[model samples]
Target chain A: MVPTNIKNFDTLVVGGGIAGLQAALDLGDQGYKVAIVEKDASIGGKMIRLSKVFPTLDCASCITTPKMSAASHHENITLFTYCDLTSLNHEGQGIKALITQKPRYVDPIKCIGCRQCEYICPVHVSDAEQGDFSARKAISIPFSTAIPQLPILDVEHCMLCGQCEKTCPTHAIDYFQKPEEFIIQAKTAVITTGFDLLPVKNNFQYGNGHIPNVIDSMQMERILAPHGPYNRVLRPSDGMEPDSIAYVQCAGSRDKSMGVPYCSRVCCMYAIKQAMLLSGSLPLADIIIYYMDIRAFGKGYEQFYQNAKAMGIEFVKAKVARIDKGENGSAIVRYENQDGSGIATADHDLVVLSMGMIPGWDPRSICPVSKDSDQFITSIKPKISPVLTNMAGLFVAGVAAGPKDIVDTITESGSAAMEAAKFMSNSHMEN
Target chain B: MKNPDNDKEKEAKKAAMKTLRAQRKDLIASASSRMKTQKKDIKAIKEFLKGKKATIPDIAEGIDMPKDETLWYIATMKKYGQIVEAEKEGAFFNYSLNEPEKTQEKEEV
Candidate 1:
């Protein structure tokens, strides 16, 4: 239900990802009332799923959780997770937004994340926590370290057995719970919805999106991660010991022949990181990487790449022409060698693609105001400012603004916050 | 006691910025002094930074330049051995005039 008080917030941030969280934090720190509306059950967004960020080599949760916790706990910021903006009406003074907070069937304020309901939950579902490499209890925290510590019931898989509802310590579970709709009043809104990974084709000749051995770059990160499914590297298809791995760069980027033509900036280093981490797992495992160019331009990133090569990770300087699933469950990679000699094939037990960033929003919607060829929001003006978008009160940051490293993303996000606040201040003064 | 490291960081950032602006100023001045360096260019920046050496980012407040047509013009100069890359100290890059002999290329051109 819409709050009867209808508190007039100074700014409303949509999407609740890193960009929105940073924007809200900056505004809130300036003593402005801010609201972050998140479609997910919690914030952190895509960054949460990442194993580790580049350059600094920090854990994703270590860097992001503080911001998430701050956003949730801030007195000046109200976090509405599991929510989406349904409708928006301009109030002349500000925007009147209707938000739908989908019921997790758990009262957020009272329920401590004690995991009582999960123990009794009868249903089993794919654990998005494990990147769907494993299953999880229906009533479960998104992960062990999720901010707000609230659990979400997998409503689709739930049988409404009501066993979990009966067992809750705080009586927080309610199967009949309806989505609470509310109106938010804010002078400006920012979209920080974050991004989704592209689906790999089943027909990929590379070991497998189809075969167990072929993994996406994200999955490789997870496997190499200390927190990933199976602390040891195990080929899921047969659970047999497989030796070799190959990383194919520009899996879906910079190829107009396919849909995406722009470079995925994060892929080069991430592939290297994955390769290095994989080497740590199998000291004897032969690792090979194929690429257009090793763009390790970020600070310390070049060092990381060199470290990988020094650790015996084979760096093949060639664009992979194709992959053929070979006999004995191995895959063959055919590519021209660096010296442009005769093309040769190399066999591998697994293949990993270094996929690039793709925006979640359709191009036609957020265009003209912030349009560009790469589908990211163009900076407000070409050279004057780097973070501001065309929309007066709104700003873009991170990959949403344009391709950038993690430090650049945060830096731009901070600048966007200042720009948004200045826009608010000037508008308020004008009013 | 003052944190000398912080002070040095602030100083380096300013110097790098000054060097960059001075180079850009040369670009705009070369293009058309009558048009005036747009608020966004390096020449306007040097004028803005006159006498102030160590300004914090919060303190470095002024309107930025609008575009880089003049800056791009200098990029052509870079290709033809006119402009050169200065030492990269940290986050910022510094640019400066070479020796008088190199600067005299404009006279011949």
Candidate 2:
């Protein structure tokens, strides 16, 4: 039997990523009770997975970890990780959300983050957090810096040898754990749902993910990350240290065929950032970025592009026609130079596709809020107030509203928190 | 007041159970032996990549295994720190045995 718990908060933030954490912290710091419902077991979101941010090249973890820690320990913030929000509906003056907590199989109350259970587990699974380039025990924490410091048992890969249960000194490993249901009532809601990358699977033009060295931008980030699977830049197909690398921009976005017609704002800068990191790591390697048009719209972004050029990272104004596997497992890129160079083909030891981003959550069935033409949550007053959603007392922030960078996302999250707090105060005024 | 036929049936079931348990033991032993033989193949891959940098196709050709199987082996070997990336040729990376100095230098960079 699953126990049903009831909780109340002044505001509810649906996501535990940077934007969500920011919004929660903003409200919580103001002494308003806030609850964060995170789909993942940890709260850092995509930011945590990243190696560094664009423009500044600052360490991504350095900026995100503190926010994660603060939100987790905030006096007025309650974090619900690994929760599936089933339904959110209006109830009287507040909104109520039904959430089902996925079973971790390890008792959170008793289990310590000692890692003994991880050591005793015999099953080894591909670590997706590290881009599947490394192995992790079946029972292990998502990462070393993951907040909450709890390990989850992957039942599918578990052998049921009772080894983890036996080795756990606290006897926190439960073989028969069940999901729990929880209800949260909040005066207002903030949707900070993030964005997902366009999948390379069955993308025929890009070799359908069959060409191993031709990776997506996110995979390139992992490859460039200090704690990446290999701890160095290498081609996935043959583990070769690449001497020549190419970045294909707009590979996933601005293409009507893929159904994502808008530009994914961060791809260009991230590609440049990764290229710069690659240059630092592989100084002898040659880097080329094939782009339709360079969008340096953000602050100091134009200079960042110029800096990359200054570092010998070649920028090619061309559209990649198709990527094919070349000899020695290299990627053959066919393209037409915008300068009327009819057609050309080049082979690069590695190819990175800057795929577009899509809304991470679809609210059609979950809530009454409408989505824009690009399928992101629609903001009624995007120009004047980007956080004001179509639904009353419901605000949208970050990539949930549209594709934006971390800087804009953080600013928008703060805006949403302010709006939600104002809405609560107005309600009190009416009462 | 037990029937003699019932007692005979019970004895027959116990004998069948004993045979099944022996079969289970044999299966476990066979699996263990198979695993031991598989280790030699992994060792062969490690030996082939010891000083040479080769792509997946190249390594598969050297080990005389299917490309998919060879890829899995490569991934596992890499996870266990048996191999390291040497260079990228085109679409494939050339992998060599993980040498301490080479990896350490790369890390410093």
Against the hidden reference, what TM-scores do the models get? 0.74, 0.85
Whole-model alpha-carbon lDDT for candidate 2: 0.86
Interface DockQ of each model: 0.01, 0.12
Q: Number of backbone collisions per candidate, in order?
A: 6, 15
Interface C-alpha RMSD per candidate, 1 decimal: 29.9, 6.0
**Local accuracy of candidate 2 as per-residue lDDT tens digits, A1-431:** 32368899999999999999999999999999999999988999899999999899999999999999999999999999999988887889888888999999899999889988986665666678877765677789998789889899876666555679778999898756778898999999999999999888847899888886888888888888887776778676655678999999999799999889999988899999999999999999999999999999999999999999999999999999999989977889999999997889999999999998999998878888889999999999989999998778899999999999999999999999999999999999999
> On a 0 to 100 scale, what is the lDDT of residue A254 in model 1?
82
Indicate the docking level reached by candidate 1: incorrect
Q: By DockQ thresholds, what CAPRI class is model 2? A: incorrect
Model 1 lDDT per residue over A242-315, tens place: 48989999887887755678887888988887777678767888899988898988788889888888999988
TM-score of 1: 0.74
Instruction: Give the clashing residue pairs of candidate 1, or none.
Output: A208-A214, B25-B43, B39-B65, B40-B64, B40-B65, B40-B66
Residues B1-109, candidate 1: write the lDDT tens digits: 9999999987986676565446446543433332233223434434443443221121123424221222232222232233343543332223333445254744744
